[model samples]
Target: MKIILDMMGGDNAPLSNLEGAAQAVKEYGVEIIGLGDEAACRKAAAEKNISLDGIQLVNCTENIEMCDEPARAVRTKKDSSIVVGLNMLKEGKGDAFVSAGSTGALHVGASLIVRTLRGVKRPALATIIPAKNKAYMLLDSGANVECRPEMLAAFAVMGSCYMARVEGRKNPTVALANNGAEESKGTPVLREAHQLLKTTPGINFVGNIEPRDVPNGDVDVVVCDGFTGNVILKLTEGVAKMILGMLKEMFMANVGSKLAYLLLRSGVADLKKKMDSEEYGGAPFLGARQPVIKAHGSSKAKAIKNAIRQAKICVDNDLCGTMQAALDELAAQSAGE
Candidate 1:
């Protein structure tokens, strides 16, 4: 499968992206289309000794900076890497698009260029959150800030399809993120969504899940509006980092503590790996007509490679098609009601 990557989009632009593309090519045996300054990409690849034999460079004249307004930048910068890369996806030049660029710009461009799946109201971002038993899918991570009951119901459907098709989870349990575990808890929108999901066929809707239970990984899919999902994702990341920092300071406090740390070093490393968001590569913008992955802005080479892998899985499993079928069933059910 051919993957289009935004080479000039992230903080580690060009270099990290090129390195990741080289690794993906060598390891995954996939063709990578690099969208950026062709000269710069070539120079960086040479300096880093990254083989570009499997990469095709598409020269882009402009780049959309992180600070630029999302919609405006996409509209005005026709030749920018983000716009051009997305256009390529829209035109079916590539199977999927991966970018570590501005989240806003990516969402805007995908919505306008690639378009959303049929019967989908708005595309939602789904990220994998590391949990106790295993990682789980968190939907609406930061796409649409506000949403209706039906929109959230759609998120649950898409999240379920992704977890099953891509993550290999069978009949994943779906849960709504709420203040309490009770069905009657949460705002009117969530309450309505809970009721809707309870009746939605195909999904294994498991009652509401409080934010605290999320880390335990009891549920396979957690659905919420973009605002709540973003808050939960950021808070979890911050807490994990703070705890790890505290552990490091304690481990180096004295000779005895240092010895103790030596004994637990392996376990600590495992913990850190589990908490690292980069391990999952990036979040996918579900409901889009084609696969579009949003890697972290500061993603390193490894993270970018993982993102490419994730996109490949999406394409291989026909994620968008599965979501469309699920959504069509929901629409038909609603019409019958």
Candidate 2:
């Protein structure tokens, strides 16, 4: 499969993107079409002794900075790497598009260029979070700041389809992120959403899930408005980092602790792997006509490479098509009612 990448979209820019592309090409046997300053990308690859055998670079003059306005930058910077790469996806130049750029800009570009599916009101950003035993999906991670009950229900449906089709979960249990697990809990929006999700066919709608219970991995999909979801995502990252740092400090405090650390090093390493965000690659902009992945703005080579792998899986599974079909079924059900 061919994946289009924004080579100059992240904090590390062309170097990290180029390295990731080379690794994806070599390891995953996927063709990567990079859009950015071709000369700079080539020079970086050469300096690193990285071969671009299965990669193609397309020259893009303009680069979109993080400070630029999302919609405005996308419209004005016609030649920017993010815009050009998204356009390439719209024109069917590649199976999927991956970017480690501004999240707002990526969301705007994907919606305006690739467009949303027929019955999808808004596209939600679905992110995989590593849990106790397995990973769960969080939708509307940072897409729509505000949403209606119907929109939350749609996110649940989309998230369920993704977890089942891509993550290989069968009839994934869906839960609403709320103040409590009781059906009477939460704001009007969430309570309404809970009723809607419970009535929505084809989705395994579980009860509400408090933010504290999210890490327990009891639910397969957690649906919430983008504002709340974004807060949860960031807070989870921050807490994980703090815990790991504290553990490190404690282990190195004295000779006795250092000896204990040696015994627990392997287990700690495994825990670190599970907590690493890079392991899940990037978040997918669900509801778009084609697959669009948004990698972290500060993504390194390893993260970008994994994002490419994530893109390939989405393309191979026809994620967009599956979402469209699921939405269509929901629409049909609504019309009948």
Candidate 3:
């Protein structure tokens, strides 16, 4: 399978992405198509001692800036490496697309290029996050600001399909993010969403789940509007950072604490790795007709490499086709009854 990588799309563009691509190619045995200036990519690859046997290069002259509007950038930045890479996927030149560029650029480019799956209202981004018990999938992670209850339900369905097919989780439980477990809790949106999820027979609707339930590793699928989801996602990251910082400060506050920290350094590192977003790579634009993985802007080689690996799993599992069939089946059932 051919996987496309943006040559200049991250904090350590070309270098980090190239290194990751080399690693992916070596480890995964998949062909990589790097998009950027041909000469630059060649120079970087040479410096890294990456074999160009299966690696392809496509030079793009223009680039969408980090600050550019996604819509405007997609329309005007025709020669950008990201646009080129996604176009390749749309044209069936590649199986999956991976980028560590502007998140907005990826969403807009993917929607416009590869297109959304049939029966899918909006293509939502979903991430498989590590929980205490097992990995859980979070949908519409700040992808759509406001979502219809039906749209949120669609995300649940798609997320469930991803879990069952890709991660092999059978009878995945879907839960609506809310203030409490009682049906009376949350705004009319979530309350109504809870009712819809319950009525939707295909999904394993688990009723309302609080934010605290997420880290507790209770549910497999957590659904929410992008507005609420982005807030919770960012807040979770912020809290993790603050707690780590406080621990470090406490550890260095005195000689006793320092000794204790040294004693527990390995355990602390393991815990930190568990909470590290980089270790999970990036999120996949789940509801689309094609497989697209979005990496963080500040991501390094390892993160980008993991994202590429994620795309391969997505393709191998046929996530798009599985999601399409599941949704079509759900829609037909609704129409029948």
Candidate 4:
């Protein structure tokens, strides 16, 4: 399968993107088409000694800047690599499109240009968090900041399908992020969403999941408004770094602490590995007609490599089509009763 890379997008455009896309081609044996200023991409590829055997470069002189309005940039920037790559995906030229550009641009481009699958009211962004035993899916992480109850419920349904198909989880527990686990803990939106999820047949809606439970790996999919999910996700990263710093400081403080650190060095290394965001690569924009995986803006070669790998997995599973069918089945089941 072929995947499109927005070579002009992201902070370190063309060069970093080209390097990563090349790594992906070598490791995953997948075809990659890099979109950007063709000459610059080719020059970068030559500098990195990246063979163009399984990769091709496309030209797009203009680009959607991170500060530009997403909807407007996507509509007006005809020569942007991100926009062109998205159009290619819509036209069946590629199985998926990977971008590290503006998050808003990716959201708008996927929803407006690539379009959502039929019957998907709102396409959601799903990010996988590496917890203790398994990864958890957080939906609408930054997609729709002000989500309605129906929208949140749709996130749960789509999130469930994602975990099941991609992560190989069955009966994945769904939880609504809230202040407390009590039934009446959150605002009217969460309260209403809780009721719908609880009553929705077939889905494993486990009660409200607190922020503390998120890192402890208590549930599979944490459903929340984009604001809350984004807060939780960023906080988790911040806290992980803070704790690691504290541990390192303590270890260097005294001979005994340093000795203890040496003893537990392997364990600490494993923990650090588990927490690496780049290991999981990009986040998938779910419910689109075609898969759109958005890699991190600061992604290196490894992250880009894995994003290409993810693109293959998404298409292999026919992820968008699967969600469409599952959502259709869920609606039909609800109506039949």
Candidate 5:
């Protein structure tokens, strides 16, 4: 499988992307087509002693900056890594597109260039968030800030398909993120969405899920408007970081604490791994015609490599095809009704 990578898109730019591409090629045996300055990438790879075997470099001069307006930059920066890589995915030159760039730019580029699937109004940004025993997929995680009722219902279906097809979850339970577990607890949009999700065939809609209960691993898919989902995603990250920091400081406080840390070092390491965002790679822009992974802008080689692995998994599982089928079935049911 071929994965198109935006080499010049992230904070670390071409170097980290290059390293990740090399690792992916070696470990996954997948072809990498990097969109960036070919000569500069090759020089950097040489300096770092990283092999670019089985990887092809496409020359891209411009790069979309984080400050650039999403739609405007995507339209004007024709030669940019994001634009070029997305166009390649649209043209079927690659199996998936992976970028650690501006989330807005990647979302805009994917929606405009790759386009959404049939019957899909807007694409949702779906990410695997680590929970108690099982990780749940959160959709609209900063994609569309404001979502319609039917849009949330669509997210439910897409999220369900994603958890099942890519993550191998069976009959994944779907829930709407709400202030309370009650069906009428959220805004009008969410209340209507709740009703819609209850009838969204092929999905195990389990009514509403309070944000607090989300971490309990009871639900497999959590659907929400981008605004709320973004808040949840960021808050979860912040709390995890803060807690980990507090633990580190506590462990280093005194000799007694140090001894306690030594006793729990293995468990602490496991907890750190569980909380690491890098483990899940990146969020997938669901509803797009092709798989588009939105890695963290500050992603290093390990995260980028895992993101590429996610893209491969999405393609291998035919995620888009499965989603389209589910959507078509839903459309048919709606039309019949």
Candidate 6:
């Protein structure tokens, strides 16, 4: 399978992307179409002693900057890596697209170029968050800030299909991110969403799930509006960092503490690995006609490589097709009612 990669998107651009692309090609045996300034990419790879074997290069003269307006940049910057790569996906030149570019620009380009499933009102940015014993999918993580009740219901369906097909979870339990577990909690939209999700076909809706319950691995999918979901995502990341920092400080306090750390060093390493965002690679823009993965803007070689792996998994599992069928079913149910 061919994966379209935006080689100049992230902070460690060109070099990191090239190294990651090489690693992905070697490990996954998939062809990669690298998009960016061909000359720059070649120079960077040569300096880094990285081989570009098994990868194709596409020369894109322009790049969408993080400061640029998302919609305008997508429309006018025809030669940009983000726009060109997404166009390639739309034309079926590749099975999926991976980018660590401006999130806004990527989202706009994917929606306008690749388009969403026929009946999908809005595509959601879905990310996997590591919990106590399991990692759960969180939707609308930072896409649509405000959402309708029906949108949340659709997110539930899309999230469920994603977890089941890509993550190998079966009949994944889904819940609404709410203030309390009570049915009557949350704003009017969330309450309405809870009711709709209860009867939404293709998903195992498990009523309301408080934010506190999320880290306990209580649900497979957590559905919320973009505003709420983004808050949860950022807050969770901050907490993990703070805890790890505290642990490091405590371990280095004195000779006695240092010795103690040696005994628990392996366990700490495991914990760090479990909470690392790089493990998941990137977040998929679910509902897009083709897979569009948004890697962290600051991603390095390891993160970029994993992001490529993620794109491959989504394509192999037919993520878009699965989501389309689920959305069609939901639409039919709505019509019947």
TM-score for every candidate vs. truth? 0.98, 0.98, 0.96, 0.94, 0.98, 0.98
Global Cα RMSD, each model: 1.0, 1.0, 1.5, 1.9, 1.0, 1.0
lDDT of each: 0.92, 0.91, 0.85, 0.84, 0.91, 0.92
True lDDT of residue 17, candidate 6: 94
| Displacement of the residue 51 alpha carbon in candidate 4, Å | 2.3
Model 1 steric clash pairs: none
The residue-by-residue lDDT of candidate 6 on 227-328, one tens digit each, is: 999999999999888988998999999999999999998998899888888889999998889999999888889999999999999989988988888999
Per-residue lDDT of candidate 5, residues 232-317 (tens digit): 89999899889899999999999999999999999999998888888888999999989999998788999999999999999999
Per-residue lDDT for 274-315 in model 3, tens only? 887888788898777789898877889899989998899988
Model 4 lDDT per residue over 22-66, tens place: 788878888988888899877877887877778888888898988
lDDT of 1 at 229: 92
TM-score of 1: 0.98
Off by over 4 Å in 6: none
Number of clashes found in candidate 3: 0
Error of 2 at 4 (Å): 0.2
Error of 5 at 65 (Å): 0.4
Task: Report the C-alpha lDDT of model 2 over 248-298, residue by residue, as the tens digit.
Answer: 999999999999999998999999999888888899998889999999888
Candidate 2 colliding pairs? none
